[model samples]
Structures are given as C-alpha cells and as structure tokens.
Target: AQSVTQLDSQVPVFEEAPVELRCNYSSSVSVYLFWYVQYPNQGLQLLLKYLSGSTLVESINGFEAEFNKSQTSFHLRKPSVHISDTAEYFCAVSDQSNYGGSQGNLIFGKGTKLSVKP
Candidate 1:
C-alpha cells in the first residue's frame, strides 16, 4: 500500500544549527507532498506543501523542502534553527489528484522529532 517514511525518529541540534529531516513516500498515483510541524502542546501546523509548479517550496518560518519525483522524497530542511524550532515534524502525502471528487486524507509518516538544545 502507499505509505510515507521518516528516516529519522529524532534529531538533536544546538541553538543555532542546520537540520534536515528526511522523508520518502511510495504511491501508485500522483500525490501532493506536505510538511507539518507540531510544537509542544499544540496542534500540527502546515510548514510547506508541493501540489504543483516549482518542486521547491518554503515556509514563512524559514523551513524549506524540495519534491523529488525520481527519488520519491520530500526532505524538510532549515539552514539555522532556534530552540523554539523544536517540535515533531511529519511528512505527509495526499492522493487528492486520484481521488477526483471523493474526499481525501493525508497519509502521514511516523514523524521526526527535532530537539533543539541551548
């Protein structure tokens, strides 16, 4: 079945450091890629998405990801992170294109926990 995979369960970084969260997806039909961030004690918030157009997408908070069709990957990245950046990041895929008029849901990965230290 179609699924999303998060290569790292956890990532630790200093107050100011670069980080990358790896993600890969497998699906028979076309899909939309999304990256979500869940801060502590809060709901998941959309970080970025790739539906069409440029393969590269970025979030307002300095996060970015590139959709690679050949590799079936959409890895999340940040050039520099702060303590507030600590959170659980999830990679998700939606087969909305194939669903046509039907309701669609996101297929999420296990998630990568990002821990930022002082």
Candidate 2:
C-alpha cells in the first residue's frame, strides 16, 4: 500500500517570498506523484506530476516539485509567490497497479493551505 503525508497543514508567506510545501510517501512498489491545487470556489486542478523520467517536474505557474527517491519525498517549491498562489495544495500518489493511466486510485495527503499575504 502507498500513503502520502504532507508535513505542513498551512504555510503563510508574504508576496514575493519563497515557499515550500513538503510531502512524503511510503510505498513498496513504484509509484507516480502529483500535486493538485484548489483555488477558492474551484475544483482541484493538477499542478504537476512525476510519472517517469526527470526527477524534477515543474508547473507553468512557477511551481516546481522534485521526486527524491532516497528520501521518499516530492516537495513543491516556488521561488516567489503571489497573492493568487493562495490555495489548498494536495499531494497524491498512485502505484503502478493502477491500470491504463487511470487516476482513480490515488492516495492523497491531508492537504496544505498556502496563504499568501501582502
């Protein structure tokens, strides 16, 4: 079985400040990692994913995550954040057993709320 843990429940940062949301996972087999973000009054949206190749994956919105196999961590980071970056971030994982690229069986973390202040 695979499980995900997000280290922080909330992260408060000033605008233009850097931020990092930590996530760790435990699994006996190969797995895929993903970051999902939910803005106010919106559904969760995929921020980035790590399927294969490239230990580091990035999202268009200036967020990046690195897959560290040794540490079993997929931490999301942004050099500078804006007020719009405030949202709920979720870390999810899917083992190889989940067939056909389906995202139905993903294990999710408790979620981290990013609060960007002026």
Candidate 3:
C-alpha cells in the first residue's frame, strides 16, 4: 500500500520556537506529497504539497517541506513557530494518478501533535 509515516507523535515547543515534523513514505509507484495542519477542533488546512516541478514547497504561513525522492521522505519545518501553529500535523500521500485529480480519500499518518506554548 502507498502509505505515509510520521515518526514523531508530538512536538512541544514555546512560541517563536523552531520546529520540524518528520515523515517517511513507502510506495510501489510514484506519489504526491502533502502536509496538512489541523487546529484544535477544526478541519485541516493544506500546508503544502510537492507535485512535479520543485522538490521544496512552502505554505503562505512559513511552513516548508522538501521532497527527498532518494530517502522517500517529506519533512515539514518552520523556522519560527507561533502559538497559533499549535495543532495536529498530518503527512499524506496520494498515487501519482490522484495528484492533480480528485484527492480521493488521503492516506494519512497517525499525525504529529504540535503544541506551542505561550
């Protein structure tokens, strides 16, 4: 199965701290990468994606991730995080066919809980 794995179950940091959420994947064929953030009791927002061109992608909010084809990984990073960034971060993957197409139900990792202290 084409699946994503988030190694860190949770990452706690103070406001304005830097953070990283690790992720890995295993797929038989090509795949699209994504990082989605979910606020407390809220739906997820698309943080970023690695589709075709660039290996590195960023979100408007300062989060970024690099798609490492060799390592089969896509890890999220933020130079300085805020308390608002406290949320659950999910790493996902879709088959190449579903990249631009309908994002069919995403295959999600268990998720990494990011807690930013005030």
Q: Give the best candidate by TM-score.
A: 2
lDDT order of candidates, top first = 2, 1, 3
Output the lDDT of residue 86, model 3.
88
lDDT tens readout by residue for model 2, 1-118: 9999999999999999999999999999889999999998999999999999999999999999999999999999999999999999999999876675736599999999999999
lDDT of 1 by residue, 16-113 (tens): 89999999999998888999899988999989999889999999989999999999999999999999999999999988565572148888999999
Provide the RMSD of all predictions against the true structure, rounded to 1 decimal.
1.5, 1.0, 1.6
The whole-model lDDT of each prediction reads 0.92, 0.95, 0.90
Off by over 4 Å in 3: 98-102
Backbone clash count, each prediction separately: 0, 0, 0
Task: State the lDDT of candidate 3 residue by residue for 1-118, as single tens digits.
Answer: 6888899998999999899999999989788889988988899888899888989999999999999999999999999999889899999988876645537667899999999998
Pairwise lDDT winner, candidates 1 and 3: 1
Worst 10-residue stretch by lDDT in candidate 1? 96-105
2 or 3, greater by TM-score: 2
* Prediction 2 global C-alpha lDDT: 0.95
* TM-score against native, each model: 0.94, 0.96, 0.93
Off by over 4 Å in 2: 100-104
Judged by lDDT against the true structure, how good is candidate 3? 0.90
